[model samples]
Target: MSEKIKIVLAEDEPSLALIIKESLETRNFEVIVTEDGDQAYNAYISEKPELLVLDVMMPKKDGFTVAEQIRKQDKRIPIIFLTAKSQTQDVVDGFKHGGNDYLKKPFSMEELIVRIHALLNRVENNQGSDDGLTHIGGYIFDYAKQSLTYDGNTEVLTYREAEVLKHLYSTKNEMVTRSHILKEIWGDDDFFNGRSLDVFITKLRKKLDKDKNVQIINSRGYGYKLIC
Candidate 1:
């Protein structure tokens, strides 16, 4: 039999933590549950789990802080934020701190499992395309390095940012709805996620602004069209 995929879960609520752990275990995942941020970081460092599911609120250290600390060392380990703070800025902050996906509180076990599966599949599929490269406007994007280079300059992008840009580039000149992007990237199309998608779009606009030929146009209440 293949080895079970390991997961490090940091959640302060005992009942919720227990439920998530039980659910993951039933799905054949090896879960290490921690109630505080400190223990969660320790578990991550020692156990080296394949994925991390973290709550934004925790004792000793918050999920954002832990994620920042982890990102300093490991950039590719998938991090998912589980929090009740669904505000636009909060979601932006979560992504800035290294979250690959966000799940608001009151989420269902099935939703969480589906997200886990989607993320794991994405990570696995990305491995085979490490050397793939794409051209967007005047910039050269290297998938393996997660970087964009233009005119002798290169900027390394965060994992989520790279994914968003790649998707936009793939469908350049076509309209992509906010809900479609949220579902494709974050696995949900909630209000907070809609706001978060806006944040990412703003960042991508800034990054691709140097190329006059590349434009990300907001369709106002509909979606965005990336023209290159």
Candidate 2:
């Protein structure tokens, strides 16, 4: 028999955590629940869960801090952040700290389940070339490893970042619609997701800034064009 997918869930609210745990367990997921960031990190180390669902506002260390700490040790693990913070900077900070996905408060359980499955599928499939590498301007992007190396310094990218950058690189110098990217990578072109896409684009631009020749330009009201 196939083993159940294990998840580490860090939520400070007891009632919400219980509800989430029960809901996930019913869907064949084995969940380890922790109330604080410190506990969450400890659980991650001991249980070695396949995925993590973290609440941003925790007592001990905040979800972003925990994610940053974990990323130092394991960059491959998928992390999903659940939080009430919906500001643009908040969302950007979550991704910058290594979160693969972010779900704001008052979200449905169905959406959470779908996101969890999507992340697992991506991890299992391991998309990319046979060599898992690509070159853009003066940098080397290793899609398989989810990293970008420039001038001998490598920067690790989150799963979502790699996915977005890969798509942009594949269609370099050509305009790709915002709707297309939102639909393809995010599963929908809703307002929130659109904002998230913008955040990712900003991140990619910063990462590729070392090579002035490489730029992701906005075509306002249309899409983006990655010039390399």
Candidate 3:
């Protein structure tokens, strides 16, 4: 059976939200609608939707805060920001905050639908799993366990770490851009996440350094290359 596209839509404009909800439902998407950022965050945590459509201007919290919190817990969910602020800085700031795609107010429902499908498609491509396991250097990755065992001792990895390692292992010796890492491991790209990624890189380096044969090569502002 085909999986239903799960969506969390947070729009304070009730009429706009309803229009988007109906349009998505007509396309067979499973949607959870909310009117505030707090409710959006609740929907994200409780329902764990596949995709999120957030509005910047909302009561309780803003889309940026909601996205930031979500990034800390779940990194593999796509996010789209819908807002009326068309300023250059606002658009740049949205991407810097964790938006996969940005849409201004009064957007065509059809365009929004297209963007949704495209984001979901990209997510599907990145989530493609092969073999369910990968071995690098002296480490044998148990993707299912989200743990790395070296020298008979196992170290538990955070969700993002595991996903990042797995993808890196799969694409060993290739240049995996930071954007690719964010999209595949955290589902969005932003400033908060950009810093978190550095921390993850440090942790990963420490974890795999025990085995000299395994190296996570950093390409500066680029990404990582897992060498075995």
- Tens digits of per-residue lDDT, candidate 2, 134-188, equal 8899999987677899999999887668879988887999999999987767666
TM-score of 2: 0.86
Return the TM-score for candidate 1, rounded to 2 decimals. 0.88
Cα RMSD (angstroms) for every candidate in the order listed: 2.2, 2.6, 6.1
Question: How well does candidate 3 match the true structure in TM-score terms?
Answer: 0.59
Clashes of 1: 0
lDDT by residue for model 1 (1-228), tens: 138989999998999999999999999999999999999999999998999999999999999999989987877788999989867888889998889988888999998888888998878876766577888879988866678899979998876788788888778899998778888888878887778778778888898899999899988988888898
- Local distance difference test, per candidate? 0.87, 0.88, 0.79
Order of the predicted models by lDDT, top scorer first: 2, 1, 3
User: Candidate 2's C-alpha lDDT?
Assistant: 0.88
Error of 1 at 132 (Å): 3.1
Q: Which ten residues in a row have the lowest lDDT in candidate 3?
A: 126-135
Off by over 4 Å in 3: 128-228
Best by TM-score: 1
